[model samples]
Target: MTPFTSRIYLLRHGEIVEQDVLAGGTDLLLSDVGFSQLSQACKYLTDVELVQSSTLKRCSEFATQFSHNHQIPLLLTDDIREFNFGDWDGRKYDELWELTHSPSIGDFWQSPWLVTPPCGENMADFYQRVFLWWQRLLMNIVNNHTHKQLVITHAGVIKQLLGIICELPKESNQQNMFAVGYGKFVCVEIYIDNMGKAWPKIVF
Candidate 1:
């Protein structure tokens, strides 16, 4: 068995406009505070190698800055877009709470995996896309044999990645695993064992 080391760093993009709402799939740019957060995050990753971000503007903006300063190419992929909120996009939690007929939203509040938003994607679908994306990313890391790979994406994307890497149950909680404030960052170190399995060893 051969031990291959591939370190992947997952980062949730900074805050966006209307964050208090359930703005899933809404392609809004980062807020002013988000810019500050992105700047702070760049400082922490000054030594990172490859950089990538979701196609969405919020993530892409920060990725551009990081790549520019570090002189590393920034790649964009659609695999990391935020969860599609469907009809719920651009609406706030309070608005959803006001809907009297739909108990489904309440169910989603309790267990996000159980309730599929009306006209939106189910948890399984979301997980599958994320998993596929991660597999591709892992393949790239293995091919390049990079020591550090930085990714800027959404909170939902980060949560799914954590679940996969940590081997957490699919039904695990989804509360703020990386609710990284605008410009703040969470560092996760993924290690590849001798069997070619990648797992998160350290997260900060």
Candidate 2:
């Protein structure tokens, strides 16, 4: 029997314009600070291989810089995009808070995992999409046994991945689950033994 090993570097994209604004799927570019963050992160990860990022501009732009610095190709995938806030898109927190008194808004906040936003996906559905992408990477490990892969994506996607790796409850503490800072990274090692059972070991 053969053993396989894979390492994943999960990176959150840098700060963006109007973070408090629910600009889901709005395609906003990164701010100046975001550029600096990307440069610093690239300097830190000088040896990472296989760079990939969400297709959105904010994520892809920073990924491009890292890819150039590391000399790795950048692949874009939609599965790692930010959560879609639907009717709440482009609105600030204060604006949304004003409307939170409505029953529909209340329900959306109370059970975001189960309740779909008007014309948008719920947290579960969004996680499913992210999992699909991760599944593809696992398949690559099974076939080619690649050692290291870097994924640059939105904060929400990173949080969902953490939830899966840690086996936390579906609606676990949001603060702890998604606290990845701008341009920061977390590393996970997936170890597969002779029987092909994979265990994820996280290294912060």
Model number with the top TM-score: 2
Model 1: colliding residue pairs: 37-182, 37-183, 38-183
> What Cα-based lDDT does every candidate model obtain?
0.76, 0.77
Per residue, candidate 2 scores C-alpha lDDT tens digits across 120-197 of 767777878977887787776667666787888877788878887777776753524468888888898999778766
Question: So what's the TM-score on candidate 2?
Answer: 0.87
Candidate 2 ranges beyond 4 A from true positions: 100-106, 171-176
Any idea what lDDT model 1 has? 0.76
lDDT of 2 at 21: 82
Query: Which runs in model 1 stand beyond 4 Å of their true positions?
Result: 1-4, 172-179, 193-195
What's the distance in Å from true for residue 204, model 1?
3.0
lDDT of 1 by residue, 106-155 (tens): 77768777788888878888888999998887776656666787888888
Clashing pairs in 2: none
| Cα-lDDT of candidate 2 | 0.77
True-structure RMSD for candidate 2? 2.3
